[model samples]
Target: MTPFSQNMVSVSLWITVVMLFGSLCDGGKILVVPVEGSHWVNMDILIKALHGQGHSIDVIRTFNSWFVKENSTYYNSITILNTSGMDEEFVEDMLFKMIDYERGKGQMNAIQLYLHVFKAIHKTHEMICQLITNIFESEDILKTLKEKQYDLMLTDPAWGAGILLAHELKLPMVYNVRWTTTGEGHFDIAPSPMSYIPVTGSGNTDKMNFFQRVKNAFSYLLMDIQNSRFNLPLYQSFCDKYFHPRVHYYELLQGADIWLMRVDFVFEFPRPTMPNIIYIGGFQCKPAKALPQDLEDFMQSSGEHGVIIMSLGTFISDLPDDFTAEIAAAFAQLPQKVIWRYTGKRPSTLGNNTLLVDWMPQNDLLGHPKTKAFIAHGGTNGVQEALYHGIPVVGIPFFFDQYDNLLRLQERGGAKILSIATLNKNTLHAAIQEVINEPSYRLSMQRLSHLHRDKPIKPLDSALFWIEFVMRHKGAAHLRTESYKLPWYSYYSVDVAVTLFAVILIFILSIFLAVRYLCVKCCSRKRKTE
Candidate 1:
């Protein structure tokens, strides 16, 4: 080739490389404040995706975090020493109590249960107060964080600490959330009519009878009262202290630029949603990889009978001895092989067919062809995975939001609910049998899987694009609504309604007065002529 042609080819290759690198990432700096446990699990997925795209991420965590690691390849950690929220011991104790209440073994009544939950949630907020106080009080941490100059805040607003920091930094905020500090994420950003939209923990579907609607309204009211009384006050104090008095914490939360909701309309009830709210449900799910040698062999051993998997998610692996025994007895009767994720002692009736492990590849097993059913605790991650893989569920919800999650599946004819309170060997076996033998359950779930998967782009890729969209544009402000800035009266249009009513009344009265004056004038003219 000629010398000019050779030089031109080299220049073109160099330009192509530069464009590829730019497409991968602009290296935008992101500050991530995530919640612990399952919340952290999903957040980690997003962090890894961002890191792959060549963005810089810094995570804010407690010094002794339960799930978040201090050392990682993808992100840096900002550790707040010796302070934490969502105490495990505290939460687990309450979980067991709620289980007991459902079982009828406890003297705790409904009011008592409500109070117990309220107290636990309040205590969590108090710890949140201490955590944020530590950050705001420390001059060195504050000064250094300020110097870093992050582009945006990505947080799980399940706690309000992230909200405060985003505002403190004056950076745009995005939420990787299903719930916020006070309630469900949708209620914060969207209009939720109690008549149709069931409140969390109500265990009612979108379509409700009169009594169910009443129950839904009551549940929503209870949450509102609990949050306003317990959750909001603790954070509101900080907003009052650190921000302008007029700036409420709720406003800061609702004013976020993007809400990357961890739920989708397929699983979630249909409701009005906002433009900035993006659904990325089941983003963590993928096609199953090869199982480990031992697990693979066990999976194959199940043969035509297939296998059933049970997991209670990240926390609460141990149940009462009787409860474990009941499940064990039920599993022993099954022709299918059982893999149960349990960290507790072996139950006396644990059968040859049953295998208990401290951990299992939950998603992989769910995707496996030999897998027939999932015995789940109704956690969002587990449920979403089951949906993605078309696994029918026999849901055994232990406590708090589990019933709500499972209800969605049950309503869709894809799952059955077996409460821990009434769970025994017979009930457990029957539930398992019902899901496995029932063709409708599997078919229902498979339909949902198709719906969830039939999208223009993968959920994770969509999430990445939106996150980068915020970074590229600085914030998704145009997509966000200004309703958060309005007062309640103005938002509901009460003032407008009252003004229109008054104007109509005045117009009617003016017409009446004109008619009366004309009648009197004609009568006086007739009397003068007489």
Candidate 2:
């Protein structure tokens, strides 16, 4: 019971309290895994923002190799796994299967149906399930995660493994749907008068054309089937092995502390959102960085007519030769300098004003003062980058959500859309000129860009703040909602009530007609007998 011993004990207690307080107040460790291309852009911005706030960040990139060939840019703390091997195999297998299915069906069904099924199965079942398994099996990754004891995990909803990992670690997880999860989900999450899902049967309330609406409804139905058949079983097996018995897929989503969407409410006007989901739009921008030396020189040569940057994103670079030729021809005639990110071989008869590179630092280029406009495939990241930089876009969407994204951008008056299927030199040339010469497009983009930048805190800061908030609260269970637990019909309010009412009305009318006819027959018979 010496005073010296008591003082030593007091000092130890004080240090422990100080460490805990700092961890709680200064933002705790966060593990982020953004599976695909643009997801990385958002994650990078998030990490930088967290770093600025003195928080520790560890990023585990699942698909880094597909974008960057070298290991130069990856951070020392970041763990980049060779996810390419599995992903390529999965994609190839799924594509070949789809092709086979289409060939077998012949003219029985449209190829689009098969493609939709393939995407849903591959994305949700194969890729996501395998990713979860890989993370669980990787002793090194698990060990590192356990050691760091991350207070929160932020992940792209596309990477379903992130959900599983967060659950297993007993840490709070936030779903970051970088792109519109579903067309209607976008409308539901962030309602906009401009937000349209191609559905059938329209009034003024309808945004989609007739065929488009039918397609949307069919896509939703097909996805529901695919989830029930493929995804549910796989997810159930994982749940059975790791956690409680008979856990539902919906339960996993409902358990999440928060859902973060990378969509600006200003652009997605009249957004319909739940309490749990937060619209942290334009979270994808970083502080302006200088462009490459060669790029800068090329821009300087263009003089007053700034450059238009062209990229079809990474996945759809397998552009047909005819399309490439058309693009090349269009770029050749333009007075402005053209910087095209062509993944394939360079075209012949290249113009002096054009430059073709395998890839360019997109954000850096967009941030450049001389970059006037962007010609893109309308990927979420590309669109966000253009909006953030106050640069107008000429969107030529190819497939998937790109179509919907371009539509939103067009609705915002910040961009123009061109059909990829019917692209030509004249079309490309005109679109470019229109975007560049039209003052309204530029002004609209600038206005949106200002709104994006003028947020109380940057998107990243908001994301980090929420993560720490979850940690401080030890999980934000109150934020989760019961709506996810309801069936799809209940959620949409299209259940048995309407069906029952219709059936009862039909039954009553049929009975009344039959009774009236019998009474008339009896009266006629009595008259004849008399």
Q: How well does each candidate superpose onto the true structure, as a TM-score?
A: 0.92, 0.76
lDDT of each: 0.90, 0.68
**For model 2, how does the per-residue alpha-carbon lDDT over 107-218 read when each residue is reduced to its tens digit?**
3355665666555545545656766677778888777778878888877665456777777787788767644222233432322333353321121123566665566666
388: Cα error in model 1, Å: 0.5
- Model 1, 386-458: lDDT tens digits are 9999999999987778889999999999999998777999999999999999899999999999999986567
Pairs that collide, model 2:
190-271, 191-271, 191-272, 198-212, 198-213, 199-212, 199-213, 199-214, 200-213, 200-214
- Model 1 spans > 4 angstroms off: 1-24, 509-530
How far out, in Å, is residue 290 in model 1?
0.5
